[model samples]
Target: MTNVREAALDVIEKINKNQAYSNLLLNETINKHKLIRKDIGLLTEIVYGTIQRQKTLDFYLDDFLTNRKKIQPWVISLLHLSLYQMIYLDRVPDRAVIHEAVEIAKKRGHKGITGMVNGVLRNVQRKGLKDFSSISDSAERVSIEKSHPLWLVKRWIEQFGLAETEAMCEENLQAPYVTARVNTMKTTVEQVLHELSEAGLDVIKGDLSEDAIKVIQGHLIETDVYKSGEVTIQDESSMLVARALDVESGQAILDACAAPGGKTTHIAERLQGEGYVQSLDLHEHKIKLIKKQAERLGLTNVEAMALDSRLVTDKFEENSFDRVLVDAPCTGFGVLRRKPDIKWSKKPEDVERITSVQWGILDSQASLVKPGGKLVYSTCTIEEAENQEIVAAFLKDHPEFSMDNTMIERLPNGVEPYVDGGELQLLPHYFGTDGFYIATLIKDS
Candidate 1:
């Protein structure tokens, strides 16, 4: 039997040294090992836990290394995995982790390096962790508490005040809940819940959206209901965007930036094959993703296209669509639970650059809505510049459009009053969903 710890070490090395995404590398390695269900769980935990707490692990390592010579990336990765098991997995004894690390080091490195590895880890075990209070910087404290990069922590502190920033950081550390939207067109929520329960799955009703079901302790992907396209995995916050659009049957809808077709499929399902849903994204590959989803959901009204929404006026007549959804891309600070590495990878300036692009897309797509038609602007981000400020600025420039408060009434249940001048903002910690923002606008006749 291959050592599951060794496999995790290999995947961690690829993530840190080779600069690969943690999820992608984990999936690839798991498939390659052909591991049993239990080993697969262990391998996933070790890899993700090590990467997620890398900053804390490195801080612990500082106590052990005397000279702190530049260690090779793979050795550092191996040490991280060993330390993670020693500290986090109480079932795995410390001596066993040390033994495995020493053995792996000896096999992969020279005798002296193996000795160094053993000595350093043992010293850390003895010295315990260093306190961050000594640093005396608020940003540094936030970084240690949240395991976030100092720059990001500093930015949040400046933008959201210390207490709220700390809360946001703490929220990001929790494991994300598995939320899925029932395809009402294919099966009712009651039918899906009954079928899932019969299959020995543990699921609970979602708090915010009636159509959403939160998976408590089962892999819904393995269930026939999910595989057969009776449900689609989407966040409760995301499910609100489609419902907020208040789509009607026999209307012509344009989903700008639609890829992987989550919202597009939801719109089609709501329309019940009465409306024509044109799903357009910039990439040809993404067009296939939309097509595949439509095929799976048995949706006939969605037409997938590979065209830029920003240049829609050149291709389609003005006032062409009854409703247009511009789910513009932004720095995804909202879904950090799924993409932890983004905390380390993103720069502060990235926000401004991405917001600029979002503005252009919003401006271009707003023209596609017919006079008296509705337009929805949404993003999976909590940043004000990407959410409220974007919509506020758009309304100032366009006199023909006005806010629609009635759209909020159509949202899923328990969604608090996040509406401000027709926009809705959903914070992750508050909504138990990814941070999301939505605004509905109607063109004045």
Candidate 2:
């Protein structure tokens, strides 16, 4: 348990210093420590919970700490981890939490530091934390309560209204479900669910896409079902991209910014070993990931290459493909449930830089879509500037393309009402899914 707390603190400290993503760092720490299954759950809970509620935890710690500037960053991180378990996790008693924290401080710091750690936690346990509800400013209150940045909270309040922004912020703190896309080329959703159940895992059907399955209990990736390519782990909202492309047999497709190939492979599966899909990424190593998924799923039609999509015109002529997908790079605000570290790592200024990259990718790839063909722009972000504004800017500059309403017909039942003016902005509160945005466009014939 002490080792588990220490492991969680190690991940949190690195994340604070901008060393690595929380998801990656947590996995690395777990494997490095060779933690068992039970400890793995506790470690994950502490790491994610601490990061998810970081701003709120800091608000609580501010009441107890006399001089926060003098405290070491790692020591502050330790407090965050300890306070998280004390406030959020009911299974661990107050005594056990403080004992382990003090033990960690004793090993890592001097005598005075250990005493400080002991005194602060014991005081917090006795006096209890102050209620953040008393905060008068809506954005500040929501930011502190939900553990999101104050800037983000204010931005969202302006876009989504105060009520919806608060709901979305609340939703971000909850853990996301493990969703997988069933490989139709290899099997069906019913078959994968059966296989998962037979393996003693609790599973359910996804609400967004028919191809998705939600694993309620146990590791779906570790099972033979996933390794054998019967399923690929993906978010339900992300699985919507391939369906929006409306692929048919033998249609040429281009997946710009394809990597780690979740959607690229889903598009290939829809083609059913018939159509050719040209998948491109800037990095050679990421292209390898696409190829691996393609090979694993026995997809023969996907041709992945190590080339920047912005330079795509250099290799392919205009109007060369039947459909194109620009899963543009943006500040990933939507999937905060899965990657809470994104909340702290991404700055508001990143929106302008990423939107420029997104527009560049769209501009470079738009000419590749065949006349009368479809092109879909999607992102794992809720920012209007990144999603709807980029599409508006594209349509304003290029008159040949118009919003395609036909794609909405193909979407799953519950999601169409959210589509306004042929674009869908899925907030985290929408369906307990990631905050995503999608807009489908048609090239004028």
Candidate 3:
């Protein structure tokens, strides 16, 4: 059997070096080693847990290393893996955790390194962990406690205040909820619920969107319902985009920046095979992903193309569509629960950089909306600069368009507090949803 702990260490090492994404690398290692179901679960937990709590783990480990400069990089990863299991995993006995870590160290390094690994693990087991209360600065305290970058925590605290930022950061540490949108054209939520329940999965209708379902237990992807295209895995917050677009049958729609077509397919499904959605992406390969998703959901009304959204007017006429969606890209701070590495991968400068691209996409897609038609600008980020500020900038530049407040009527109830005027910023802690932003705008007739 593959040593799950060692596999986790390998994945974490690559992640630290910026060599591979944690999820992709973990999946590749699992396949290469042919790990069993139990091992797969353990490996995934350790890899994600270590990366998720890397800062906090390091803060504790700092106390034990006498000369940290001398420790091998791989040894640090090994210690993080072991400490993550010891501290967070109640089911794992310290003796077994330390034993496996030492064995892996012995195989990978010399006697001196092995002794160091054994000593650190044993010390942490005996000494417990360092205290966060010692950190006097509130932002720094929250940053280390929640395992996020200090800069990010400070920015969030500045934008959202200390209490809300701390809450959002704490929420990011939890496991992401698995929710899927029912393909209304292919099946109803009730029908899919019955089908999933019969297959022995713990499933429930989503609390937010009527068309969403939450998978509480069992793997939905391995089931026939998902494989046969009756459902597509998407966050409930994301499923709100099509509804906010207020799609109608026989109305032409454009989905700018629509790769891997989640919202694009939702809009197409709502069209019920009547109207076509023109989807665009910068990369040809990602355009293929959008096409594949449309095909899988048996959606006939989606036409995907490879083109930069900034050059969209080069191909289509202005005022061309009844409704348009610019799900513009951002830093993706709102999805930290699923992509914890994002906390480490993204620098503060990245926010300033990506907002410019977002502004460009929103500007280009604005011209495509027919006069009196609706346009929705959305992103999976909580940053005001990327969310509300971008929308504010677009409205200022294009006086012909105005915020469409009727989106509240189209969305699910209980979202009014989040919706300021026509824009909604759904923070991760708000509804246990991914941090998402959506704004509905209308072109003047």
**Candidate 2's residue-wise lDDT over 406-425, tens digit each?**
87788888887798766988
Error of 1 at 293 (Å): 1.4
Full ranking by lDDT: 2, 3, 1
The lDDT values for all models are: 0.84, 0.91, 0.91
Model 1 reaches what TM-score against the true structure?
A: 0.94
List pairs with backbone clashes in candidate 1. none
RMSD of candidate 2 to true structure, Å: 1.0
Weakest lDDT window of 10 consecutive positions for candidate 2 = 416-425
lDDT of 1 by residue, 235-301 (tens): 8889988888889999999999898799999999999889789999999999999999889888899
Clash pairs (backbone) in predicted model 2: none
Model 3 Cα shift for residue 326 (angstroms): 0.8
Top lDDT model: 2
Q: What is candidate 1's local distance difference test score?
A: 0.84
TM-score of 2: 0.98
